[model samples]
Target: MAIKSFQGARKQQSDTSEDAPFKVSDIMCKDLITFKPEQSVEEVIETLINKKISGGPVVNDNNELIGIISEGDCLKQISESRYYNMPMENDNVEKRMVKDVETIDGNMNVFDAANKFLESKRRRFPIVVNGKLVGQISQKDILKAAISLKGHTWDK
Candidate 1:
């Protein structure tokens, strides 16, 4: 008797299948709470608290992402003010926000984006297109995408 292979037929990756890679744009948050560089740190803090967000992107009137301001940046201001015994005045997002901002492409795969988050230790990434701010992707968004993609083959 001839010995036969026991493995079942494997599923081939298909571009048109539901298992197709999900892009960052598919899950990114389009409605973002952005701030103006000239906005006060106090105002940014207030919006962060009210919106229950850790941080937000600072944009120009043209909606181009210029920087990112976070709770940690605000806390730094607080600590410095206390150290100098000075009031938190004459402070704005531009004065404290991180000007060197890293952005993610909208067409990038979600898994790749997750790897980026892991490597960079970033809580969120701004999605920019043609030098214009479009959306944002967060750790939570990646988690949600993973959960949704469960039971599907993540070949990539």
Candidate 2:
């Protein structure tokens, strides 16, 4: 189906060229490679390096999101371990993960999500459905959604 702004139930007249509101599911990345709390920090870093990702959501065995792990979180520990000449293999992700993660609803409008990005310093948000991790929405995803919406204009 076409993503036209002024069409069907969303055909309300508006001044701006943009009008239709899109949801997070329209642009969120579904195929996410998640990590567990018990997993090693070294392994997570290796995966992030290999996959070319900056971070990933930390989840439990039941697939419930617990925290978020990023390269910034690992930097201090990695440096300290390297200085002490300790084994990085045993350091778990939980030790450095940010536990108070802010998640977003998958049904939220992409515009609202964009505002979140603009107002906050976070690079990405974990999209949740019924309290379970479903997907991820990045700044790039928001930009992509905006570009897709640009092709659609108000009928008025």
Q: Rate the local accuracy (lDDT) of all candidates.
A: 0.91, 0.85
Evaluated with TM-score, which candidate comes out highest? 1
Off by over 4 Å in 2: 1-21, 154-156
Q: Give the TM-score of candidate 1.
A: 0.89
lDDT of 2: 0.85
Alpha-carbon RMSD, each predicted model: 2.4, 8.0
> Model 1 clash tally?
0
**What residue pairs are clashing in model 2?**
none
Candidate 1 off by > 4 Å: 1-3, 8-21
Candidate 1 per-residue lDDT over residues 1-156, each given as its tens digit: 999899998887555345544899988999999999999889998999999999999999999999999999999998998899978877889999999999999999998999999999999999999899999999999999888777777755
The TM-scores, one per candidate, come to 0.89, 0.81
**Per-residue lDDT tens digits of candidate 2, residues 55-131?**
99999998899999999988877998999998888689999899999887888888888899888889999987877
